[model samples]
Target: MKQTWFERAIFFSWYCGIRDCAYCFMSTQPDSKKAVRSKESLLAELLLCKKLGWKIGFISGGIGAFSQTKFKDLLKDMYKVSGEKFWLNIGALTADELKEYLPYTKGVVGSIETVNERIHDKICPSKPMEPYFEMFEDVSKLGLKNAMTIILGLGETIKDFAELKNIVEKYNITKVHFYGLNPQKGTVFEKSDPPSAEYQAEWIKKTREEFPKIDIQCGIWVDRVDRVAKLLKAGANSISKFPILKKFGSKEAKEIERQAKLAGREFRGTLTKLPEIDWDGEISKLDLAEELKEKIKNKLRLYLKKMQKNYF
Candidate 1:
């Protein structure tokens, strides 16, 4: 399918220092922070993005936000591939690191997840992410343009949205992404079901109503956003779908352009109609690349399974 043009496209690649994210999609136990992207693999991804005319970048790749070794390698590769222009949405960075990275970034996002410390640690037990909140202050204080993603339904209450709204008010975040907890087949929290689409949208709607400043966006359920588009009308700047995360080619991505167009009509006059998103088509055209990534992941899993079997 031919793709429609978007103002820009965000090409994402993810890694984990914690092997498994606090709420990860992979079935295996979490890995350690020491692993960095291999040059061969990183270059392959960049090469693919280059083929698709995508302005390449990286995100949610472990503790690289603190400006650590693996992150440094990731940054070096991104710059190396995209040259002077690239956008990064790395997860959980610190204020101190932002000072160093803000210049290199067209934009940076430290998805603070949830601001409540007790709850934050309870979910993300492998790492103490409370310190990462400092980056929000730095992003706002420095007037750095950035984005923030807040995960919902990973065991959070309505009060969590209120607290998150307050914290973001202090930052100059360009966008706020409300991601529904994806409890895929494996992971420590796999048994948990995400909150209902209605409930999730309502919470996001209420939060935006109370704090009607930034562009409030939703991920996963585009239809839900259409429903809550009224309360969110005054506040919502965009509607985004994460059709692809660590993986690519989701039915959701291809539908965004139509979804955005439809949602814009639904809340007509209340919201701005952003251009269509060509995310899925982008991946489909890059079929060879997507297949290669699947091959690599399968190999990696097979290798790891062997290693585990040997150790056991």
Candidate 2:
């Protein structure tokens, strides 16, 4: 039998690291803190992706709603090559901004690491949860579907996770993932312990029961089968890994795959894609999410009307 190529639709996935979240693996590298992967390097990586016939993936330290484009000049260049199949991590934004960028997005990811304001503030200082309002506001109006996430082990309470569930339920978030906080060596919380596999496993089960209507996932690294096996048993469908970029067919990457096997998880040298946080949902609801859409449209329509009348 022949081996399968990741060129198939679901297999081609990538992570475009664009967030202001406290936990970013690339930031832990030897140098270049707060680094944004260059378009030049990204373009080169895409070239390799194109050659390998494998799905493309991109991961970065910080991007999206939390930070401005590192290189606006490269947008056309990236689009000319990468086209529509890309995923981005959204940190934060407002309703108006979501409307402005809605047309260009394939999808979004609101990395609301924690729903609690104080814990959120501590994990990511100088950042707030205001972007979620815009995200909810826009996705409702524009008819966008997005993924949502909650990062565990940042000192959040059960109440915080419950609030996360309520937010997704209220907004109709299509895909929901829960991630364990991986402390980078130099970050303020570097000494913190990641949630134990057993703890993660238990939470996965509990979260599944709590949000029975939506799909749930845990970080792919923690324990692909264990952390989420019960969730799967509890009727969850989607699952994922932390999305590190080991070079295609590299020995080190292959060895990592071997480790996954030992943990009862497996990878097939396939590409994984990550999407940007739903900027459109954060901006406008051209898609008709009923209540939230009307709220945002009233604001936008008003803005347009004011423009027509030169209210400014």
Candidate 3:
């Protein structure tokens, strides 16, 4: 069967959230300083992504200190600026919150890191597992699509795979994003190792064989670039969070491209397609306040400068 190939452009609105998930890289304690990006910066990034013809825009990351009202306003601004529906992966929202965000949201992503309640409780003690499942049900009932992110190598057992199947089926999930737990230095899992490429591939293949139509996306980090072809062959139709490939012009990126072709798939948009544009000139023309416009342009200028010096 033919597969759809695309790389989603994700916008990190903030870095830290309220939850103290053990596996999270961000500071989640009460006194943790939230590195929330300005509204202008987020709008700037979204606008640039829209101009680049990337179809999907995800407001991803931890639920920072944003109130419901503030988040809703941000969503309104995002929709107004881009004139495109976006997805949210900022943790679970209540039924009412989901409804409020329904207009601007194309879907909601639930981070079901692990299906085992014991492991989940131990690893992400502050994050409730049931809420995510509840949110998925709410998202489905609201007529919006729902997806999930699952992390492997969290001491999850083979029995968890059966539970995963049940959850996907019960929630009417359309997509499942698999990530090999990239242990951070200070996190609880710091001394632990990530799942092997083969282990991840086996589960992905099982998912594909069971649910032939579901979209399976594998998150490819810098260390696992070589696993691209293996994952593609296993059943992942798309790759996620792999910006280094396009941004850095590395030989590994070239090799991944070769592997994708070998598996008879094409990476559409952000993965392999970055158009050259006049950043300052184009951002200046956007319908935004002068101060905001300058902010966006300056941010882009710095990013471009870094990219040019180090990668391009």
Q: In terms of lDDT, which candidate is strongest?
A: 3
Note the Cα lDDT for every prediction shown.
Answer: 0.51, 0.49, 0.75
Sequence-dependent TM-score of model 3:
0.88
Tell me, what's the RMSD of every candidate? 9.9, 15.4, 2.7
**Superposed model 2: Cα runs more than 4 Å off:** 1-35, 47-76, 157-159, 210-217, 220-244, 247-312
Instruction: Note the clash tally of each candidate.
Output: 2, 39, 0
Candidate 3 per-residue lDDT over residues 102-165, each given as its tens digit: 8899898888888888898888877887889889888888899888888988999666788989
Q: Between the candidate structures 1 and 3, which one is better when assessed by lDDT? A: 3
Winner on TM-score (2 vs 3) = 3
**Clashing pairs in model 3?**
none
Clashing pairs in 1: 19-31, 20-30
TM-score-superior candidate, 1 or 2? 1
Q: Rank the candidates by TM-score, best first.
A: 3, 1, 2
The numbered model that scores best in TM-score is: 3
Query: Which portions of model 3 show Cα errors greater than 4 Å?
Result: 1-19, 27-31, 51-57, 243-247, 270-274, 310-312
The CA lDDT at 4 in model 3 is 36
